[model samples]
Target: MEQDIANFMLRAAKFEFFLVNRDTSLVHTKVVGVFTAIIGVNWTKVAQFVEVAFPFNTFDFTNSGFEIFAQTAPQYLVIKHDGRLGWDCDNEPIDSWDRLLTRSYAQLRNNVAHGNKHQMPAPFTHDRTAQFLPAGLALMNFIANQVFLESDWDTPIFS
Candidate 1:
C-alpha cells in the first residue's frame, strides 16, 4: 500500500512536469499555487504515512533517523534508551533510507514549485525528456524498497 502511494506520487510529479514543459500557457499563477499546496500539504501527509509504516525510532537526535523522522525517533527511543547514550552506539548500523527519501522528495517538490515555468533548464534540453524523470522514478523505488518492503508492522512498537 505504501509502495502504491509512492508510485502514484511519482506519476503525479511526472505528469505535472510534462504538462508544464509542453504548454507554456499552462504555467500560470494558478498552477504554481496548486504546486505549492501539493508540496506543502500532500507531501507532508505522505511522509507521515511512511513514518507510521517504517517507524524509525531507534536512533538519537544526532543520528540520521532523528534528523529525518524529526521528533518521533527521539521520543520513541527514549523509552528503551532511558537517557543512555549507548543505545544508538550499540545497535548495528541502520541504513539512512528515511533521510534519502525526505531530501529527494523535498527537492522534487521545490523543483516543481520554483523551476521556471517559461524556460527549461540546460539539463532539460528542448528535445530531451529523460533528464528530470529519473528523480521521480528513483524516489518512487526508494520509498517502495525502504519503507514498504522492509517494514514489519507485526514487530512491537517502541512506545
Candidate 2:
C-alpha cells in the first residue's frame, strides 16, 4: 500500500518513468526547470522536516556550481563511517554520493532557472543533466518515501 502511494505520487509528479528518446539540449535545459519546481514544491518540505535549510537563492549557485553549493549547503544526508545512511554530523570527512547528487541538482536548478537558461557549466552540461535525470527521480522517490514513513499526520503541510 505504501509502495502504491509512492508510485502514485511519482506519477503525479510527472516523473514516474522518464525517458529521453532524443536527449536533446532543449530537454536537458527544460528538465532543470522541472526539477526546481518539484524540489521547491515537494522536496523542500521533506528537507525541512529533517531540519535542512535548502538553498533557493541564486547567490548560492552564482559564484560556483556544484562545488560551492556542496561546501555551503547543509550536509544533512550522508553515509556514516559504519556504512549506514545517516546524517553528516560526525565529521567523518567522507563525502556522501547522495549528498553530492543532491547538491548537483540544486546547482543545476539555479543555473537553468536563474542563470543563462540555455547552457550550464562543466559538470552540469546538457549531457550531464540528461544523465542526472534518473538520479533526480530516485532522489525524489527517496524523499517521498521518507515523508510517508516519518510523518505522524498531526499537522497538515500546505506547501
Candidate 3:
C-alpha cells in the first residue's frame, strides 16, 4: 500500500514536496542543491498548463505578478500569469504565449544551480498552510489519477 515505486518515481523525477518545515524555500529562493535534486525550479509545465487554461495572459499584473487571485477566480488562479506582462516585478516570467512556450524554468534554476542565488521576492502568504497541503496533494492525485485510484479515476481527489 505504500506504493514504493510510485514514491520513487515521484522523487526521481525531481518533484519535491517543498513542505514548509523541511524544504520550503524550493517555492522561492535560498535552496540547498542536493535536496532539491532534479526537479529544479522550472515550473514551465505548470505554466504551460496555465497558459492553455488561460490563453490571454490578460490578468492584472499591476502590482507585481505575485498577486494570487481568489480561489474562485479560475482565470488567474490556474496559470503562471507572472512574467507575462509587468514592469515592476523582481523577476522575469514569459510575456507572450509564444515567449512562454519557449521559456524553461531557467532563471531560478540557473541562479540556484550555477551562480549566486538571489533571494526571491515575497511569497504567497494568503492561504493557510493546512489548506496548501491538501490542495497540493490533490494536484498530485489529479495527475496520477489512474495510478492512485486505479479504475476509479472519477473519484474526487481529496475525498
Relative to the true structure, candidate 2 has a C-alpha RMSD (angstroms) of 17.2
Over 1-159, each residue of candidate 3 has an lDDT whose tens digit, in order, gives: 124333423432333332222233424344466564333433444344445545535744333222222121211111145644211223354464333322312221222233211232224422322232333334434323422232333333252
Per-residue lDDT of candidate 1, residues 1-159 (tens digit): 234444445565554444344334334333464373222223443455456765546534342322322321111112243553211112223344344334444444444444432353343222222223344454454444554463322233254
Task: Tell me how many clashing residue pairs each candidate has.
Answer: 0, 0, 3
Better of 2 and 3 by lDDT: 2
Give Cα distance to truth, residue 153, candidate 2, Å: 14
Q: Local error of candidate 1 at 143, Å?
A: 4.4
Model 1 RMSD in Å is 18.3
TM agreement with the true structure for every prediction: 0.28, 0.30, 0.26
Colliding pairs, model 1? none
Best prediction by TM-score: 2
* lDDT scores in order: 0.39, 0.35, 0.32
| Runs off by more than 4 Å, candidate 2 | 1-94, 115-126, 150-159
- Candidate 3 residue spans exceeding 4 A from truth: 1-44, 64-93, 97-105, 117-159
Task: Please give the distance, in angstroms, between residue 115's alpha carbon in candidate 1 and its true position after superposition.
Answer: 2.4
